[model samples]
Target: MPRGEKSAYTDKQKRQAEHIEESEREQGRSKEDAERIAWATVNKQDGGGKKSGSGRAKPH
Candidate 1:
């Protein structure tokens, strides 16, 4: 995948990013900054897209 392509992200991840971006905007961050921060936050939490096996392991 190309850089900045979100095709590997799950629906939930996308939703979370969108929400984070909106929150950052509400807090006065610039549009570009908000988007960057949102994706960064998501990556920090989820460790990038779901195609990676590292962050997908969870206890049931």
Candidate 2:
């Protein structure tokens, strides 16, 4: 995918990024910077959408 393209991310990842971005913005980051940081964080945590299937199973 092209740079800045988020199509490879899962819905949950996208939501996580959105939350991160919002928090960054609240901390005074610019919109672009916040989004960049958020996506970067998600990538760091989840490894950039490479694996198939949901990651570690949650307990019931």
Candidate 3:
């Protein structure tokens, strides 16, 4: 699943996320800014790649 998974966002994390978002809003982050931030965070955490795991299906 993608990083935006609701289960991943705890109450504390949610608050922090919202604060940063609102601050970004004030800073005029723009749509592209939000997208880039999300993509960069996810990619950085995922070894600078687009996905968390290798691009392969799970073995059944």
The per-residue C-alpha lDDT of model 1 at residue 32 equals 99
TM-score versus the correct structure, for each prediction: 0.83, 0.80, 0.47
Q: Against the unseen true structure, what C-alpha lDDT does each candidate score?
A: 0.93, 0.89, 0.53
User: What TM-score would you give candidate 3 relative to the actual structure?
Assistant: 0.47
Report the lDDT tens digits of candidate 1 across residue range 1-60. Answer: 899999989999999999999999999999999999999999989778876566766545
Please give the distance, in angstroms, between residue 22's alpha carbon in candidate 1 and its true position after superposition: 0.3
Per-residue lDDT tens digits of candidate 2, residues 1-60? 788788888899999999999999999999999999999999989878746656866345
TM-score order, best first, reads: 1, 2, 3
Best by TM-score: 1
Error of 3 at 2 (Å): 3.4
Off by over 4 Å in 2: 53-60
Candidate 1 has a TM-score of 0.83
Candidate ordering by lDDT (highest first): 1, 2, 3
